[model samples]
Target: MSDEIGLILCPEARYNRSPIVLVENKLGVESWCVKFLLPYVHNKLLLYRQRKQWLDREALVDITCTLLLLNSDFTTAWNVRKELLQCGALNPERDLYLGKLALTKFPKSPETWIHRRWVLQQVLRECSPPSLDRKEQADSDLRDSAEKTRLSERLHRVLHDEMKVCADAAGRYPSNYNAWSHRIWVLQNMAQGNLKVLHDELSSMREWVSMHVSDHSGFHYRQFLLKALVRELSQSLHHHHAPWPSPGTSSPCSPSPDPQPAHHQANREATAAAPCPSPATPEDQSSVPAMPQLFHQEMELCTDLIQSFPGHETLWCHRRHVFYLWHHWRRDHNHHDGQGCGSESPQLNHTDAGLSSHPHTASPRGVGLDRVESRNGQAQEGQNAMEVDGVGIPDPCDTKRLKRGPPDPCPPALPSEHGFVASVLDGCLSPEQGCFALAYRKWLDSVIGQ
Candidate 1:
């Protein structure tokens, strides 16, 4: 690669080599450039660059496949990806190598779309090219066309099967951007008249997204579901005299239940004197916005999750989307607050220990610097005292010199509070007071509550 590209293919070309120079006491900007740019380079080159040349095609295929799976830049991977496709090794029956590569690269490059189109085009071009007239030549051409068609059909079948696997895997890991985008690309290029499969695919994806509403990736997937559903619904509603009821409305044609309260619970709790529908229980509720009305329901569920598990960073991050939407609504309304929402703010009050609020500990010093620093200093003092007694006084020459004089004074112990103040001033902790001091009353109540 270096011979072809005009640089050392191995060590000199290895990305992130600058620190190596600093550590090994070597010189040059070439090493520094290599170190700084390793993250952007393809893993194929990164791995082989550490070794001598004469690499195997399979080695490049495996390395490129892993890079595609992990999602290195599309353009960088693009250069090596052709090797995987040509190696005749990344079979759909064995693994979803090309499918995953296509999926991961879709967001950043036209190359993914190009690659898929190429798969189809090459298959067709090889199998069914135009004929030239000659009795022997025409017969040979016909046979060649037949072989190409057969091969193309086989590859297309692999393409479809691998895409299904990719979609299923994406459903399992909804947070994966590459997986989700790839699923979309697969659906887009599916055989034109397979509406039944397309509809079923959309339905399955919706169910998966609904099952994991707390996941931001799932929420994003729901937007994709809505887009697919709208198109389908629009086609179905074309003959209607009235405008279609907002999505998932009760209709004989639609499979979904009416946007009803969990009526099953209502029936379970039936009584002659109290006949209203029972409220949604946490278990019976769908966390996802199954219908348009359910979007607000999902938002409320996210808010409830925050209140229920305030210490969870994941839940807090999930709740931010609701905050963002509310903020947008407020902005549209001349800065008026949204209903049931407080002032639009992004503030999140997390403690230094990553807790949303200070947890009550029974110790005199709360979850703050006092105890941490005190313990640190006591251990340090013990070590220092041992050093002074063991080494300072034991040196015979120093002892003889000091024997005629008073013993040397030991160094003054450093104040623990000063260190605490310094750490706080450095923006690592609360500057106003120690953790215990900042909310003393709350800490006391928490202790009592526990």
Candidate 2:
């Protein structure tokens, strides 16, 4: 038996088999057995030698289990994992053990991530909901999501906190597809509240991606941020444009306290500009008028967004819509000669006197009158050159320009065209040109004699 054990532990043998059998039975311990067994069993033997009485039969059981796991005997490995967790080992490695076993043994394992979430889920399902019932008690120890009302709020916080962890982990292993996929999963889960949290998260994610802008991950991150912004902006636009009851209408459907803005002066101007569609009666003296300035405020928000994110073409398109609506609105009430720069006719205000008194410095036939400051604080021609002919004059509004021209030589080309004019037509192209397409077109037409 001793010779047999020595043969099994021989250096040339390479037997990773369990050595517990020889060590368990009163082994005539062999040289081969000692060769393979010394490294692992050395510590256990030292403990046993120091305390001989503690080294009874059951002690060998622990040794056998250790050997099985080290040898990759999976059944014994799983048993060890269960025992470790049962003994309250809550290390992250212990959780990793659970994950590994679940992957290998179950293969189609649902338990890996589920168990990880279970720790957080247990807090809400148990501690959180029950705390609400005892809230009336003076000394209740209610905390976290223990109250029903706080459950949704707490769940959101937990998810966001985990997302930060996952994002950090992804930063360490930036090429990790799994980490990024998990982030997208979390955002999709949080999309229940019109995706408000998701939008906020993506906005933050963009800041992180900025440092790694050249990476492919950054490109994908950009797509996510843009998509989320598009959704959020669309939702906000819908809310801003939603129909609401006019103030002083006593109907129960009327919004409480009347939610309109406090720009009474602006509202009065809008009312004077366009007759209110709502009916008025002497009994409802408190009825405030409709405000076109609300539309202006909305357009201003869209315009600021376009300026802030110059690459966002959709915002520019929306701003164009707002401008068009403002134009139509002014024209509808025969207020075409309004206060804006493109007014059809000027108002005879006090400023007109000042304007008429000043010398009119006109440009030469093709040269623009570039301005210079006169000693008297007036505008004067700084230069004179025939080449400046049609330059520096802001183009007239699109409708006015179209009226002056023969019907656009051909219907405007599709937005996809890459030519100078086509780029202006497409909002996705140059916004400077798109917003000023009329001026650009006029210059091009003049230069080309088209």
Candidate 3:
């Protein structure tokens, strides 16, 4: 045992060998690790099976921690730690710390992420009280409200710390799917319904996405936040309108009321056009900016990104989602306003003639190749002419007066958002760009055709 401890502590002695091999060869630690692990695991399984007292909590924790550090996918070890947590032998914070340490070694481990999620739920369950009983007295209601408020604050802190952990993991390993998925779960399940909090998160995410352009997870999270904001605005609008009956309302069976005068309609329109003050509280009856405007802003952000990363499939796919949602929203809004299918139609000129109007020309390499081909053709023609004239194929080096072909035509630029998308699709249609871009183009065409 002393030799095993020394081998673990001495970096020079541990060089080059795997940790398990070092233990097995230098100090014969495998049998010791298994000896300490198997009995504890068996005891826990027995207790779980027999529904008896969970004994030797400290020993179980020490053994399980060691085993898990060596092999994080050891489900039995994680189960033992969870039992320890339930039995009050281990605290939530300590479990979370252990999880973080394990994640540093195994960032992609599904078990580690699952265990962390379990710990978070345990923390939440302890902090928040049960929903108030309808039959309870007023005092119970007050207590429940206070407890909920406190719980919300604590949950906010816990989730904020977890977000930082996930962000760090993602930065270290950009393709860490487990870290990204865990962050999304936290946001969807744990975040409070506070617009200010959501807005701050949105600001942070904007910076993150800008820095990591190819991360689809970051972009997807942004979409989730935007959708959440839209839902909040909609709920607010519904609540605001629910209290007031329609202008001519009475009992449901009453005769219909007269239509409002044109002057009265004009006055209401004027009121709507004026700027309204921001609401003093979330529940106050104040109007949010129109939903289409929000979608338009997001669309503009996507356009900027697409321009910067012209060849990235993820960005293009995200843009497709944005457009799909935007079109649906517009359709709903127009229907609500009693307008028959919107006036602005979705159309793309899918012909080579349209390419002539695109502002950006073919890539420089393509243009260079065209120039080389034209020069070669002219040189070949001159040689053929010399042979026909019976000049005995004048010295090949003397054919230096080469005539150049007319320059490649410059295509005109398409300036609208649709035009930009169409141009990008055209550029990516080539085989070298891969199938993803082409498939997306086909999907876009179907959407426009609808």
Candidate 4:
């Protein structure tokens, strides 16, 4: 029995019989056995299977976690861990730590990412609602509000940590769809209602996009955040005015308060007539940057990035979404102000001013204007000399010049958002640009024409 135990434990005996050596080289055999084939793993697997059969939550959690650290793709093990989490035997934070460990080894594994999202969801569920109930004597509204605030703060911290982790994974693998999708899910679920939190998230994401311009996932997430921010701003505006009932008679059952003072009525009318530039209360003021300003800021950021990475299809796609949103906002603003969609609004003017003022200081087409001008001049002189030589054949250079026909004129600055987008897209429409660029340009034209 002692001799048999020695043979079983010997490296040569194990290497000869183990299928792990068939798949992995000698360099990994020792490490692999230490991590996955030690007596502890075999015992834990047996114990986990026993616990699973008996539905023992605590032991299952311990066993699943140990197995998961060694092999994150073990779907059954993750499912058992999920069961443990649901039954309250495993802490969500501990699950999160296990997820982090698993992800470090299996960043691209869909199972690991799905488990991470589940852990986050469980944490959120625990932090919210009936689980966070107040004592019986507590004032319901105040206690509920405080609990909600605390919940939001806790979720904000957790989601931000998750975002950092996702960003790190994405940096490691620029096209990691799982990482990007998980981050978007976190933002969509967790970052609503709080403008400061959204703004901070947007600021951080701007840095991330700048660093990872070629990654479409980051840009797509930015589009989601931008759209959400716009929606939040619109909702805030509605909320700010919801308390002030429109001027009209009240219900006969309840007497109305005294009519607004003339000065206050005038101020209200002024605010309603001109939607922009209304002063927010001190508490709400910080959250009230004009939507057009935000959109233009994003446009400039996109322009700078597109210039830096001209071939990046993701940046161009993101810009198209931004333009689409801006167009709708501009149209809505015009409708509210009793102006035709064709008429220039202040917001449109602001966008135009930004677009016109920031002339493409560098040639976008990778050819300098001066070089083109010089070539055209030389071509013209050659054509004149050929004409003097009485050669009737068109100079090839002249034919090329005619085909090119000097760069299109800088588009007339327009005050509509669609017009601005059209002009910017036109500038980007070099013959050498990608199919997406040309296709998007045509789509923009169709949208604008409609």
lDDT of each: 0.40, 0.37, 0.57, 0.58
Could you tell me which residue pairs clash in candidate 1?
A: 16-34, 16-35, 17-35, 127-148, 127-149
Ranking by TM-score: 4, 3, 1, 2
Give per-residue CA lDDT, model 2, range 1-450, as digits (tens).
Answer: 111111233345356665445554223333455556645654664465466535544444455333332333333333433444445544433344334323222322233334434343333333233323554554555543254345455555556655664565456555445445545544443333233454455456555644543345533543454444333333343234323211111111211121233443343332232212112232231121122333334443543454345454344444444443433332332232232323333221223322223122211111101111232233123222322655643334435857876621111111101143343355445555455545434433343222
Q: Candidate 4: which stretches are off by over 4 Å? A: 1-31, 34-59, 131-153, 239-288, 339-437
Worst 10 residues of 4 by lDDT: 245-254
Residue 392 alpha-carbon offset, candidate 4, angstroms: 65
Question: In model 1, which range of ten residues has the least summed lDDT?
Answer: 409-418
Model 1 quality (TM-score) = 0.32
TM-score of each: 0.32, 0.31, 0.58, 0.60
Candidate 1: residue 302 Cα off by (Å)? 13
> Residue-wise lDDT of candidate 3 within 355-375, one digit each (tens)?
234435433221123445677
Candidate 1 lDDT by residue in tens digits, 1-450: 000011122444545433322223222234334444545435446656566554576776665644543443455455555545556644423333354333532333345444554453333333333455788676687577565556546545654664565555555444666555555544443322233444455445545544554556655554544444433333333333222122111221222211323532342232212111122233322222222233343444544553443333444344344334332322232122222233332211222232322223222122233445676788667656757545733435445867767622211111211222233334424333333222322432243212
- Largest TM-score belongs to which candidate? 4
The local distance difference test score of model 1 is 0.40
Residue pairs whose backbone atoms clash in candidate 3: 357-412, 358-412, 358-413, 359-412, 359-413
Counting clashing residue pairs in each candidate, in order, gives: 5, 7, 5, 0
Which predicted model would earn the best lDDT? Answer: 4
CA RMSD for every model?
Answer: 26.9, 21.4, 19.4, 17.6
- Judged by lDDT against the true structure, how good is candidate 3? 0.57
